[model samples]
Target: MKIPTAAGFVTLMLFCLVHAEICPLSCICKPLGEMKGWLVDCSSKGLKEVPALSVSTRKLYLQNNSMTTVRAGAFDNLRNLEEVNVSDNPWNCDCDILYLKLWLEDFSESSIANVICATPASNERKPLSQLSGNELDSCRKSLPIKCLDFFWRDLALITFAVLVLILTLCALRKHLRKIVLCV
Candidate 1:
């Protein structure tokens, strides 16, 4: 076999460096034409926030990290994001986190169900789906009046049915008494 030429080796090294720069942090960024997903695995990296990713990234994994605070616009550029896992991170529960929590809740394909808070707060380790919007706003600590409205609607329906049944029973009793008296 012939030895590789000096010029060929230098060109190969330059190509490698250029390709490495485009790779995402802790991820294998593969460009599949103009429309395809980039895979990211950022677990256990002690990342405080998500790193810059290509617009092609659809699935992201930031689990088991030291991330304490995620800024509002951290994921704004990733419009194609379909799945994300930020589980096992030490999430700081505050009003600032409200936007991300609410956005995750509303995202059609995102699954933050396992993402939990690690803190001195009451909702620690709680699944996000199990918590109501008011409970999620526990930092605010005031329940929304919508809960009361739901309660009243159910109560009113039951009360109306009971009154209708009572009136029907009274009419039946009166009619039975008249028949007995006639007999």
Candidate 2:
């Protein structure tokens, strides 16, 4: 019933801070001894995309899922990750898988040996590391053409609207002058 001392409160806060681990949703996180790092296992959770991981994660397991392509820069924050397993997933080896390939080459080169493509018939069963940039899907190369198409369409619409507005203003000029004189 008595009030707790400041020392006891500080000890309680430190205990909570030491035990907290950033476990992602539907994932199991186990702390290494002495809190050296965490082993985040998110394998076979029916994951469509890679979940956000903590920076303290040293080992990550994300195999045997339905992931086709990971979003760009999804793994940019995991600087402390030592090992990652993303094999056995249906990886679409198109323009989208480039980010994962590049990140693996820089962070964990050995892991790339297990990443095999499952889609894009031409690249199917091919090792992601072995696929050259030129072999990617044609959509990436057509990006500039699509962008130019959008730009011209938008420009033509804007020009037509501006001309209509000018014509309407000119048509109302006589009425506007009369109204202004009365005011």
Best by lDDT: 2
Positional deviation of 122 in candidate 2, in angstroms? 0.9
Expressed as tens digits, the lDDT of each residue in 1-183 for candidate 1 is 988799999999997785565455565555545567666777788788878776767778788888866787778778887778887888765555676677777774246676677653776777655555556545555544577899999999999999999999999999999999999
Q: What C-alpha lDDT, on a 0 to 100 scale, does residue 66 get in candidate 1?
A: 88
How much is 98 displaced in model 2, in angstroms?
A: 0.6
Sequence-dependent TM-score of model 2: 0.66
Q: Please write out the lDDT profile of model 2 over residues 79-98, one tens digit for every residue.
A: 87888999999999998888
The TM-scores of all predictions, comma-separated, are 0.58, 0.66
Model 1: lowest-lDDT 10 consecutive positions: 136-145
Deviation (Å) of 38 in candidate 2 = 0.4
Please list the residue runs of candidate 1 whose C-alpha ends up more than 4 Å from where it truly belongs after superposition.
Answer: 1-22, 28-34, 132-183
Off by over 4 Å in 2: 1-21, 139-183
